[model samples]
Target chain A: MDSITPNEIDIVRASSSKINEIDFENLAFGNIFTDHMLMCDFRDGKWQKPTIKPYEPFLLDPSAKVFHYGQAIFEGMKAYKDESDDVWLFRPDENFRRFNASAKRMAMPEVPEDIFLGGLHEILKIEKEWVRKGKGNTLYIRPFMIAIGTGVIAAPSTQYRFMIILSPAKSYYSGEVKVIIAEHFSRAANGGIGAAKAAGNYSAQFYPTKLANDKGFQQIIWTDDATHTKLEEAGTMNVFFRINDTLFTAPTSERILDGVTRKSIISLAEREGIDIQVRSVLVAELVEAAKNGSLKEIFGAGTAAVVNPIVGFSYQDEYFELPKIENSVALKLKDKLTNIQYKLEEDTFGWTVKI
Target chain B: MDSITPNEIDIVRASSSKINEIDFENLAFGNIFTDHMLMCDFRDGKWQKPTIKPYEPFLLDPSAKVFHYGQAIFEGMKAYKDESDDVWLFRPDENFRRFNASAKRMAMPEVPEDIFLGGLHEILKIEKEWVRKGKGNTLYIRPFMIAIGTGVIAAPSTQYRFMIILSPAKSYYSGEVKVIIAEHFSRAANGGIGAAKAAGNYSAQFYPTKLANDKGFQQIIWTDDATHTKLEEAGTMNVFFRINDTLFTAPTSERILDGVTRKSIISLAEREGIDIQVRSVLVAELVEAAKNGSLKEIFGAGTAAVVNPIVGFSYQDEYFELPKIENSVALKLKDKLTNIQYKLEEDTFGWTVKI
Candidate 1:
């Protein structure tokens, strides 16, 4: 739990930049990366010195525990550049706390804040050029940790690697997203590692999501595994429902992630005086709301897409199309949140941190 | 789905074997590996050529999906050397089928039989010297697949790598194992990836197991997550209970693993005219039986420890010590199964296959 000073980090700059050969406007999400990345190793019950080096591949043994036992955790955040070319990180401390929580659940080492946050600050300063000066052009930050211990036994690893890799990204927009309510497959269990930002939780949804995709749906709204009645999560993000001008979202629990964007939206809605309910939304309740024409909108909130609006949803062989309306709460909240991130508006909540 | 002939495998033998340096008398389960290993890459919609080269570390991108999303699966099997120096495998086809099922569930590409089975056969032949002659000595085989696609996305990877690494080991023996019945933590959900040998499932049990270890117990007997009333699995293995004379085991469901050794034990017990019931064993029933002196035995069945007998278990904070009885079913079954595996007993079921 030792704190790492800024001087303790070793820096190795890339000789050349790939920025000139790239087109930032037309970029795929998480496809291209910044020139430099941060890495730190944990071994012998202690964290090693942090290093910011050129982004490249690293060596691992064939029997590394990460490859066999999946002891890994990750976080997703973004860095924004304002018109004055000042870089800002949106609620990075939240991600740092959640990352350690995930590490504890996965039985991995908890990264020191100085290494997690201070190393992030140092790396961002070195790669600030990758953050373009625009509201939509942000640098996606992926901080992940994996077990590097070389053994295949089903036990906690003694060695681990914490890394931060940056990718330039544009505003994410998935067209006309349609979702299906899950009846069988689930992303997590009761008293399981669902709330952690663990790697396994995401891949566990891929097969079910693929099945939904084959049926012309973009995502699945997962339900409680035991009864499959309570709606839990939308794809990998936290979901919200709008009924009769009121927003409803499930409270964070062991089965649902405490998403940063989700909490921000709840705070923004409360400040804006929008009627929002934090409770479990059952399937029957949603069906009844759709039938009575009270359901106005459905959206997912996460780091990748700050607010993703859903056009329709299928439930038990029945499809319900949400009515098109002006002044969507989802879009309004997204705009306000992004404005605060880009420093266009006053940071009333003090969520934005200048680099 | 193309078949790879023996000649299709490219072999690069190690210049010298490390067999001399390894003390065959004393070795850890997965710590020491043979000189050569098998590897094959999947890309551009098809698997490339398979290679058998010197065992060593390999490079991977920091953003590999396996590290970020846990898109990986693995199988554990062991190679046995009979008295005549002929190596044998026990029900490898079952492992092959299960491996692909795991691949399908994780949304990774299915490996062809040639690349999986054929590669193992080729590698075992080259490292045959590592397989010693004895019933307790074994060459543990680990076949695994991981997503090698470089992206920070949450979707399935288009690229993957399949490999086989052999580790020499003695018989696994954890002395006087005591277990705790799970009340909160769970290994799998009702509709989760518990049946597949997914890497994530193993790591999910580590934290809970560590908690049990701290209390002087070796492992946790996971119960149904929804109600925690039915016994599901023990550590990473399938659990069996004996009440009076009849043996009881929970049927394999979405929350339970369909273990190879577990099925073989069921078959062997039937052949020996031992009463065995495949149904859900309730926790309350087990406690009542323990109080009535009918709960005779509890054991775990898996590849690593073929038949791991539990000396005692704690349920609801009440410790229950099993009476030491002669003619223990667990040891009897373990001996019979090993005899058949080592070619000492008659191959009545035709389960063993020559490498």
Candidate 2:
């Protein structure tokens, strides 16, 4: 491999015409791809030039370490086309920092901020056509890195592949989700990888989530491993509950992901005088709140779906159905975030990055 | 994607011409390829026909869910060629069961028993030559499954690929290892993927182990998540400690893997008149044992290396360096195990299966 200088990224333009087959209105979460993709190779102790190339398949040996050992990490963010037909990313720098944080934990090389931001900016320029304007339409950008070396010794790989894939997405998760409080299984340990958005972090939850789904619950509200008493997070999304009138959520810890949307909600809730309390919410407290009808609302926050309200929950083999209230906090937060995303409201926090 | 029968799977043979180039010696772990590879697909709620094909790369779209979600599981075992040239697999059924167990936790499809064993038999027949003779030499077989669907949703993928790749090799990890007794970091939790050979389990440990490695330790002896007091398993191996002539190991739980080699050594130790204790060994207790000079030997048992003796261990800030003995249990167990593996001893235990 030839050494690639910073200025010589070799960003070849897309030769093929833009995608015209798929109707954007019916797009799912991560099915459609943009015309261009961003890539950078990590080898010989440094990251190479960030390249923007036409989206295509890259070659990999069957024995690639990532295929076997799962040395991989990823970040999920979206690019939205405003009503005035301009591209924007919501807190792109935060996404970049979180991506590297996940990389450090996964034992994969971290992408330099300059390289990460540069590649996303360059790719956004080329793949701007993929970003749609209407409500619930956006270009979902997935930034991921994988250990790509051919040698597999049940150890970490030497080389890696960093690539950004673009997908047109509507709702990341489907419908209003009902979750079960975990009494037997925990999502992460106090010293585990729950905070990072590594690919393996999600895969390990599939089985437990499936079991919960089989019991008619759509998700799991995972608690701490030492004691399954304090609520940490939903398997993917960060969860918040309304106890009486104060909005309460678990504080970010090693076992809980520091969600962008979760942070946004804290700021928005404070601005809206919602009396938000970012602290541990014990299951016993939740159960008590439920018994006294003080559990006003339960919601999940993430980039995919801004804020999704929970309808019900199960605990200790018993299910509790939640009442859907009009003008809920979830709906209000979703509107606020989406409005800022679509340039319908002034982004006072400067959360949106114009492309 | 046509329906495949058992006989059709057997019909595909290893290419006779290419078999000559394979060298049993000078083989790196997972670096040498066998003539034929074994494969089965999980779709529509069943594990369909097992096939044997020439070792080659198969195509997958870049958007395959496995690449994004890390929904993959794998197993490692070996096929030994005895002095009489008879092929043998050491407890392959155990590997199959573990593979499926990992699949269940990862939410990947379960592979049928008949197909799994049938595929192994067919692949071994074609690539029999890859199985080497002499002690510590055999065909290292890796059976793995990965979700292969082309969508990036955070849920389970509908499709999966179950495959077995063979590698000619010596020991996978070569060393008289040194490990750090974990104080702050942990590998698995109370309700985690530690019991399963899920890819995430391995990926989650890389960063923590790297930190330990930087401190001159070869591995980290992982502790239970609830309390960092008890010793669990080592990275890629199950551990055993000899304190005051009593063999002690942690009992297998939801947080510890049911390692095949660990079980084998336990059985072998009992047959050889070694006092064994299957119970938890707390860090403070072990440190005390080291202080009183009761910590005689520390060894790790796994299929890859058979027995790897630990030369030292580090706690919070204290370091315990073990002295080398003339003939320890580690060497004796390794010799006995490898002797049976090379067909130098009577197969009284019925652990070896002839193919």
Candidate 3:
């Protein structure tokens, strides 16, 4: 929203640009990075001066706490280029707030707003050209913090590292998505770090997701850990269900992430006078709806995909294929949300911030 | 159990040893490492050559999956120096098996027995001097694996690194240990990564443990995530409760770790004709026992600390101080286990492996 104070961060220019050697149109999500990245360290109970230098590898001790104890958290956001080549970010304050919440939950120090938002603005200003001007083109922003202190003891780290690395992307998923409702494996506990964007939360889903992949499914719809009956999340994103034109999504809790796109869709749907209900959707109710031909659609909402529509889902060894319909609510909400993000529509909700 | 094939491992000796400048008697657990470390890489769908090089920091990309997704697992073991200058490992095969089980749960490659055990033997041979000869002295073995691939995507990495670092230690805990029974926070979830030694499971407890530390409690006795009615674990170890003369511990399940020391203690107690029961212990029953003077002792069992006795416990604003007794079942079991480990007593169970 505002210019970054030059004194707050040290800048080291890259000797050469790698932009000319790359094909931006065929880029893979989170694969290709910009020429520069942001980094800051925390030691002796305070954060050091920030730095923006050439993107490269760094050294760490073998006993860094992140390797042994998994004290790491991350936030995912995206930068958009408008028609006049002006860059914008969608609800960056939300990501910044959630980042510190994750830090506190993981027992790491909270990052100041100046370092989180100011560093983001400064880095995006330096890497503006990487944000291509197109409807689908975006520069994925990954702001993460990790425990860098060295010790094999099972305790919180005294030192940490905060970094911002940008990757150019097209889209995250490209397929007819099929998911499995988890009946055994779970992603979070009753009072766990599931609400936080902790790195551990993602890896916990990998094995289960791989199992679903082997069965021709792309992801999983995680249910309640104690009683695999209530739906919670879809893969790494917040999930939603549409039955009889009434949309239902689980409210955020200790076992569910508060996704940015998920909240925005709820707000937009309410604004457009759509029947959106926020409550726990039961597996039994979903099966009954599918059997009675009341289930219309299922989708996942997060920053990565914005809204990922599911073609079908499997529960208790029975696969239910969703009916093909026109004017899908998921695509409609995605269109409205992306229009505001790309500066193609009026910003009635005031969610986007100019970089 | 057997000598490693010389060709199977590449040894790079450290130019100098740091042993001359240290105080081993006052050593803090897992703070300092030995002169050499073992490393192996998995890429192209298989583990590469194993190497034992000087202990040092290594380079990694800022976007390494281990830093972003927490795709990591580890094991804890120890090497004991007997009276005749011989090193022996207690149930190393158990640690190796558990390590691979953790790997599979986290979607990482399973290390072959030769590399996991053979590489350990080779490294121990090189750093045998680090294993101090005393009843309390030990060379702590920390074998871990982490995702090394560079990407911000939420998926399993194709590349991984397995490493073994040795830390000489005297003991893991000191002073009286007071525990707080978990009423809100939980360590693991049902059908989750609780059974695996995944790094995430440890960090999740740091925040709650800090809260306990602030209240003058040294550790927390975690309960089941579903209801918080059943006792599960203590800090990072398996917990045990001695009511009257009967010992009880929760059985290994999807939500509890199958600890090596825990099993050893059970076996040792059974051999001594002590009443041992592997079943879930409820909080209400424990409180009732405390009121009736039947709860004799409560302790933790793990690789780092063979047995850690609790001085007192607090639950729901009420504290119960255990009565001091001369014949502690915990100490007796610990003495017997360590005696077998140090070759002071006969190894009737065939649990020790010569290095």
Candidate 4:
């Protein structure tokens, strides 16, 4: 494990290709992968030289801290291809910054920007062919860190593994979604790991979200843990509400993720001179707005789906069906973000990086 | 990938033993593992054959769900050796029941009893020599489950791996522990994964616990998430207070783990005719009792350290030192539990299982 300087990266090319076996027409979101992956190790007080090798299973000691204690964090982003086969990344710097923030909260070492962004640059260059050219098709990039130390003393790990894997994906969800406002179960507490892209944050919602699914809901709109009166976020996504013409979303705090897509939409809305409010959104007010037909549209903002529209929402015994509008904020924001990502529109905000 | 029946266990003995290389005199808690481990995999909607294989590194896909989503749960127990060379387990059934309960909360498949307990029975038989005969020396058993599916999806993994590993451990802590009442950080919410032995629960404390450690405290006495008013659990342990001659502890709720050692201590205190109270313990009242000299003893109960005595506590810029007392409840309970565990006391409660 030689120490890696800022700009050096070791590469090992695969002997053969597995890309021909993949079916891009009916691709699952995170299933199929590219040929190569990127990896770096934090061992003996410094990050070792990063390497791009053929994507394969690696052997780990059974007592690795990651299997016993959840000291893991991940970042999700996507690369889109234009008609000319040019690759573009939508705001990879935000994901990079948030990845380190997640590491700091988990008591793990942060990867340097050179190692993170530089390694991604090298791997994406090699695997750019995996980025399919279409409206919703993409090469989903997952950069993650795990505690790979070989002891299990209920403490932070000394050794860490940071890796990037690429998987081709189609749109996450096909149609409009229905969600239930969480009343009993809480996704995260005030001083917990809700805001970070911590691994445990997603797993904690699976059970409660399963209950909502059983009751005919596709997702859950989680509320604040203290009183469950203020809406916070949806499962794996940040939520936004459009009341009449004003756009409202919960402010980012220790309790809510400062999502990349949510901020992008806020910026785009500001550019469009639309009324935007970032504050505590009360469930009572949202319900009242729904009753008075002021709640025009509801959608989720995330890296996976860009924007997912919600057709209806259920609260306790009453279900509110959101009125369909000719011009939806979700559709407008999704189209703008996608156009920038696919290189169809000018990158005025410099949100997309070309490779 | 063959299906294993209830009574069938495939065994693959280690080619060579690493036991000679290990130093029993200076063994860390979970560092030195035995020669063999038990494993069973859930694949394609059914659990495969259980196997007791030589302990080795496992090859996992880079996209394994456990690394990305933290779909993992674990249990801790111990095995003791008597003078006659008979090995004993203290309430293995309790750990088995709790493991499945944890699995349920994580939306994972419940491991069959035969796979869990039977695997433990076989592993103990093969590595009985790891159970050292001493007052504190014992074989610490770690049973854990992890999501092993080859995908980067945020949803729960369909494939699972259940494993048991053994490590020789002495007493966990060496001195009297010091803890601070948490004022800002909360561990779990009213409807979160606090009660489950989920992997994330331990890692979540590392950051905040490090804050207490910096302030010279060894652990933290967490309060309720709603207001941080009532006492909850101490760092990974159930807390107890001895006010005057009565014992008090927080009642088990969704926010607190139902610790096995806690219940055992309650039963042992009942048998000794000591007054025991299980209810909400307010932090204000606890502070007042300490100030007035009614708080004689504060201890933590768990599987790692049967009972860990606390010397003092800090709250809101004020540190209170507890006067040491003769006939301390922590010492009494520790002696009682270890005696029962090592076959030095009567087996009146039917707690130990001899193998």
* Best candidate (score: lDDT): 3
Q: How do the candidates rank by TM-score, highest first?
A: 3, 1, 4, 2
Name the candidate, 1 or 3, with the larger lDDT value.
3
List, residue by residue over A67-148, the lDDT tens digit for candidate 1.
Answer: 9999999999999999999999999989999999999999998999999889998999889999999778899999999999
- Find the 10 residues in a row with the least total lDDT in model 4 chain B: B1-10
Docking class of 2: medium
* Residue range A1-355, candidate 3, lDDT tens digits: 3445977799999999898987998887788889999999999999999999999999999999999999999999999999999999999999999999998999999999988999999999999999999999999999999999999999999999999999999889887889999999999999899999999999999999999999999999999999999999985679989998899999999999999999999999998888999999999999999999999999999999889999999999999999999989999999999999999999999999998
Clashing pairs in 4: none
Better of 1 and 2 by lDDT: 1
How much lDDT does candidate 3 score?
Answer: 0.93
Clashing pairs in 3: none
The better-scoring model by TM-score among 1 and 4 is 1
lDDT (C-alpha) at residue A316 in model 1? 91
What DockQ would candidate 1 receive versus the native complex? 0.86
Runs in model 4 deviating more than 4 A are: A1-7, B1-7
Instruction: Indicate which candidate wins on DockQ.
Output: 3
**What's the residue-level lDDT of A245 in candidate 4?**
96
What shift in Å separates residue B195 of candidate 2 from its native position after superposition?
0.7
How do the candidates rank by lDDT, highest first? 3, 1, 4, 2
Error of 2 at A344 (Å): 0.9
Interface RMSD of 3: 0.6
Listed models, DockQ each: 0.86, 0.64, 0.89, 0.78
Model 2 lDDT per residue over A16-116, tens place: 85678878878777877888777888888888777778887777766777778888888889899898899999998889889989888888887876667
Question: lDDT of all the models against the reference?
Answer: 0.92, 0.82, 0.93, 0.89
